[model samples]
Target: MRACGLVLCVLLLGGCSTTTDPSYYWQSVSGHLRMVGAARPVDDWVADGRTSEALRAKLRQAQQLRRFAVTELGLPDNNSYTRYADLQRRAAVWNVVAAPDDELKLKQWCFLALGCVGYRGYFDEAQARAFAEQVRHAEPDVEVGVYPVPAYSTLGWTNWMGGDPLLNTFLGYPEGELARLLFHELAHQVVYVRDDTVFNESFATAVERLGGARWQATASEAARAEYARFDERRQQFRALARATRERLQTAYALATRAERLAAKQRAMADFRQRYDALKAQWNGFPGYDPWASQANNALFAAQAAYDELVPGFEALFEREGRDFTRFYDAVRALARLPKDERRAALGSR
Candidate 1:
């Protein structure tokens, strides 16, 4: 939807021709319900229906999450999810999404709670799919799974309470790290520097580690185990991200110099060849094929972005002595600083 007549519609969600009413969110739920009723349906996927059992299970899960959100997260009881869909639809979804037509309604929900009202969510699958397709067409190396969308991307304006159900798995993590995953994404929602992919992602990476424990405390033992599994997987990811970052440094030096273009190409080709071999060397570990085939301009542009400043996350975590709350305040404080100022702060005592 258009925010204050601005073209803020995330084009991938099958956005309509005109901008949406951003201020509409300022209204109450009754107001949002009326607003959505007048809008046009977004995509063909909107008509696709879930099975009865699926709906029931989703509702149950959502109820669980609603309780979690309130009991653990301390959100308001009367969340927007209540007005949108019944327990069934909300439970099935891990995040709440706005349809092209329901922009104002979603925004209202966002504006009202500043976080999710319930545990479960609603989303426009078509839009998420469209964004996925666009991201894919733009950069094939990045693989996204719609398990839960990145909260930072969707909930920023709403104050990072709600989250999308989409996730990235370019390099899959090990089992039992669900808490880490949640923490990582939540961290992104907490603070993000616009268009600065590396800084934003790295900050989230650090938070995921620091915040995992607190988030897990709300869930059951099984959920906590999942976080451990996820952690193991992350250990491997750290290696890959670091390697990618170093490799990108080399690649970038070559990319900038015209005279070395051909040499760089040859070097990259060799690097890819070695990378493939390197990937194969750890055959039982993980597969790199599916993503490699989708290489494009974005892939080249963000080739080694995965671990460019991993040490920053590591350093922050270490500096806080693994104190989660302290880490949170520290980062949020730093986020207030300008780019260079933040860097200087990081470097100074």
Candidate 2:
């Protein structure tokens, strides 16, 4: 799963007066302009003699996935992903997530257009780390984790400025994984609600999983096999993380603070032991090693936003007869409801 940050206010550069922090808004504006400035039409890249053959092939395949997203998945057919950019870096942005040491609820940052979201994203890694330090300083009991984000969505807000371009950060992903990332980002443009990160991300996650499966059904055997290996590890890791979160939540609810803290440490230790067993079963695959090492209340809370409500959205799709258009309509109806009501409707499904 790709962890996506939202740039909801990128187009509102002129509205800086609405933000409490001018420097933050300026960085968002400058960083987005720099990325959009680097992009070129995919056709140009394919025709360029200087382009590597491997890259040309990947760009062409991306265009095919983009078309499939529109014609088959009922996604927005817009300027997004029609071009490409190479950020010359590992990640497009770094996201900072924070939560109280004893709680799973993440600290929320309210933006002018995006309302309140659980994480803050920065284009520069140092800036992100500095902000994390500030968060820790402000609340001594808070746990902060900063992680790289491969891509983000502007939510169709910047279509006039060439929209969101495909970036080098994730262009080399496996075929099935590529399809899932693209589907997930495009789903944001389909239906999004203010201040509901779990609702929005889980809805997108459901789309990615559903669309990725459809894509793999017609993909080459090698691609299918590769995706199977990758997804299997991902599923196992998510299950472990989910169980750890549940156990910690139970621990946090104990009668006394000392008991809760002791229980939390025990749960985390067990989680690491279980993960070690999984790595052995996987023949020493270490893809999730970094995440496991950095496991904390903030990281667990952030991960939950992408997983918690996925089942309900998947169930909604099934109830809508698995029709793409009908499923989207049903989701949009739910999006219009108040947040509490929307959660109830999905929970019932």
Candidate 3:
């Protein structure tokens, strides 16, 4: 889930001012500030001879997509995604997510006003790993994961400072993937519930999938073909992951603890075997092997956050006649409902 920049001030300052927890506050504040400090205007990069031609082209395409997002898709025309930032790292932030070893349910981290979320993000990777280790130590039966986040949205909270910027971490994505990333992040700014991970992430994922298809339709033929190949593989991978999650869920529900553990091992082994078979279809793609090898409850829960409820949102979009404004309005209306009512309204579990 995307972290709102406004929440940072509250999380950081409120901790120091109101609560006794100052260390966590200081680290969060420092990390976020450092990231925001690194942004530079896209034009500045373009004018510099230091910029590579490929990067220049991608930036130009990003500008086009930004306009399409606002004008064509009715997304907010804000300072977000208008500028660029070079994180000079492989990832923009590292997120710590945890779940019980015996269940797929995620552990919640509650903030003062933001309610609770399933994960916490740190700009520093080491800090994220440390936090994950702490969680593991605290709960012996907890499964923890430290994963990298390429980009995140502040929900337009930093528009005054030029909103969320295009980052090097994600700018190098394939054309369709890059457009989807921007659209997905920007969708977070459109409608965000305080503590509903399923609602927020699934909505953004729907937008990315929906908007990406439209973008692809108008893209150059070469770009379309390239994305087709990438997306097909991605869908297959997601299907495999989802199937494994269901198997794990079933395994965890076993009557006996010993049986559950045995089933869990079998499911994991099958997951790896299936992934290896799928990898062959991709002509030796190793991009997802690391994830398959280290699959755990925390990782599965994280994936479900983005994947679950997506079908429901997509159905809602179709019901809205594929109109962006109508779809967003409908989603916002649902967002106002009580959590249970909201999910019920969407006809999703």
Best by lDDT: 2
Task: Give one digit per residue, the lDDT tens place, for model 3 in 1-349.
Answer: 2212123444432433233566667777776677778888899888889999999998998998888888878899988877888878988777788898878998877666555678877778888888788888989999998777888777777788788889998888888888888889889889989878888988999998999988987899999998898888889999998999999999999999899889988988998888889899888998786677668999998889898899999999999999999999999999999999988887776
* lDDT at position 72, candidate 1: 47
lDDT of 2: 0.89
Compose the digit string of candidate 2's lDDT tens values, residues 1-349.
3687775544453343333777788778788888999999999999999999999999999999999999889999999999999999988999999998888999998765677789988888999999899899999999999988888998897899898999999999988888999999999999989889999999999999999988887899999999999999999889999999999999999999899889999999999999999999999998788778888999999999999899999999999998999999999999999988999988832
**Once model 1 is optimally superposed onto the true structure by TM-score, how far is the C-alpha of residue 323 displaced, in angstroms?**
2.8
Compose the digit string of candidate 1's lDDT tens values, residues 11-64: 222222232543322222332233234322222113336435544444344445
- Candidate 2 weakest ten by summed lDDT: 10-19
User: Model 1 misses residue 150 by how many Å?
Assistant: 6.9
Q: Could you tell me how far off, in angstroms, the CA of residue 229 lies in candidate 2 after the best superposition?
A: 0.3
Cα displacement (Å) at residue 296, model 1: 5.9
Positional deviation of residue 301's Cα in model 1 after best superposition, in angstroms: 4.7
Candidate 2: stretches off by over 4 Å: 9-19
lDDT, each prediction? 0.39, 0.89, 0.82
- Against the true structure, what is each candidate's TM-score? 0.50, 0.97, 0.94
Cα lDDT of model 1 overall?
Answer: 0.39
The positional error of residue 15 in candidate 2, measured at the CA in angstroms, is 5.4
Residue-pair clashes per prediction, in order, are 28, 0, 0
Best model per TM-score: 2
